[model samples]
Target: MDFKDYYETLGLERGATQDEVKRAYRKLARKFHPDVNKEPGAEEKFKEAGEAYEVLKDPEKRAAYDQLGANWQAGQDFRAPPDWNDGFEFSGGGYTEANEEDFSDFFETLFGRARAQGARQQSSRQFHAHGQDHYARITIDLKDAYEGATRTISLQAPEVDASGHVTLKTRSIRVNIPKGVTEGKHIRLAGQGTPGIGQGKPGDLYLEINFRDDGHYTAEGRDVYFDLPITPWEAAMGGKVKAPTPNGVVELKIPQNAHAGQKLRLKGRGIPGKSAGDLYAVLQIAVPPAKTDEDRKLYEQMARQMKFDPRAKLGV
Candidate 1:
């Protein structure tokens, strides 16, 4: 795939407003469309404009491209640096904003195939096409994945207006997050995407699931892992301890003399699945500080009564 300057293609500055980009694309598309104009390069020019409009028109793709900086020239030798998109919020949704398979190589390099986009656009062209399908991604608590949830999302769609002009409109709608849905998987919403042109039907919408960052645990596949803080005595004399899970708090028994970082597993406590993963509690021992006289006396007594030497292995 080649490189493209979406900003320049639309004849807009890098900082152009979403509205500005959309307006530019509408004007150019209408002007250069082969159906509307017979110029020799009309089709090619229209495609180039569409490709640019596709990226700049979306808030997500725009942000990702913006981070590439406004310094690189259009058509310049470009390759994604190792750290490119290091901190951007790409859903890896990886769909072209333009509907057709008519995008430039530059577009495909960054994002994968525009297959879905093409399908929707082409389907829209059918004489009685139904509504096109839309796609989105959202993050929620692992609990949301465990137990179904209801969430409201805001959608901004780039659409063709009554005058055959391209424009964007914003709307919000509520959706259900089904239980046991995993990351990178999609949830479909009937009649949610772009409305069909003519007497065509409306398209469906699909949303991919992602987990929000949690302080208590990190999820992988179907498993959940968490660090459990414990006192020194608990490590030396392990017993039942309280642990947190998506469902609720639960008691986990640990073996006596359990070492720090020892893992305790609770079967079927993780994500819901046929062979559900277990929840792991990795113990982190907390040493008491010598802030009180009693604490200092206990340490002094231990030092006097024990011959423990941490540096003995170093022959110090």
Candidate 2:
């Protein structure tokens, strides 16, 4: 999809303050309003100005959009990076405009549809409205799931300054990660969202769980998987080899003539919970290079002595 530089659309610079953004948008809205200007593309320009203001006027949306960096130009081919808004906290519904369909695909791609109709419905109640719930994602180590952990995470939210410029307000929060918590799980923090209206209660903050990519390990549901490298001798003959688990390292038994890609399961060694998952150690054979004469002789002796043909079953 083509990148829509909101700032450029409204004839503003990247560093334009919130007030500048507002004034620029107002000027464009007047110049392009369909009733005032009967130009062929006036209506389209008006819609574009509205869309730009929709994002720029809101500090939270503007902060998230600014993350795309200042190097991007208008109408450039653009795709948002995966999880670009992962840690950003957003309040109210995604897009508050009444005419949602009028927004372009570029807008939809950045901010998804309203999470629920409750936010919009609640606006009708003028007496007391509940604060808008916020959502974000936090990444943790895989070991944090095995053993419950307390982590300190920093989050950024937009704050309007005295000059009406939007600035990011950063705060550090300590969170508890429950044991056996898998990916996609959410931890809720009460009264951590946008402030309420009148005597309404504050909203909540929901943090989605994600595990950092550790090269050695991967998880599926509760089950854990990792490659266990073994010497060629260990694969040829039964032996005990040290394997690393989330909890700790343990000795795993290799079967006689164990082939590469064989899996050895450790019962209840995965994430710790009422119904724990299993840990699979996928075996990979490691061959020693024949660098010296003795090593070469040893390999030559094995090749000559062993009459086994690995491809015999393939009829090659």
- Shift in Å, residue 192, candidate 2: 1.7
Across residues 192-287, which tens digit of lDDT does each residue of candidate 1 receive?
766776787777777767777778887878888899888777777878888777899888777788778888887788888777777888888888
Worst 10 residues of 1 by lDDT: 85-94
- lDDT against the true structure, per candidate, is 0.71, 0.84
> TM-score, each model?
0.62, 0.78
Which residue pairs show collisions in model 1?
2-106, 129-200, 129-201, 130-201, 131-201, 131-202, 131-203, 132-203
Off by over 4 Å in 2: 1-4, 26-51, 72-83, 98-109, 113-128, 287-316
Model 1 global lDDT (CA atoms, 0 to 1): 0.71
The residue-by-residue lDDT of candidate 2 on 54-89, one tens digit each, is: 899888889889888888888889898866776777
**Candidate 1 Cα outliers beyond 4 Å, as residue runs:** 1-54, 57-60, 63-131, 158-168, 197-201, 303-316
Candidate 2 local lDDT, residue 198: 79
* TM-score (C-alpha, index-matched) for candidate 1: 0.62
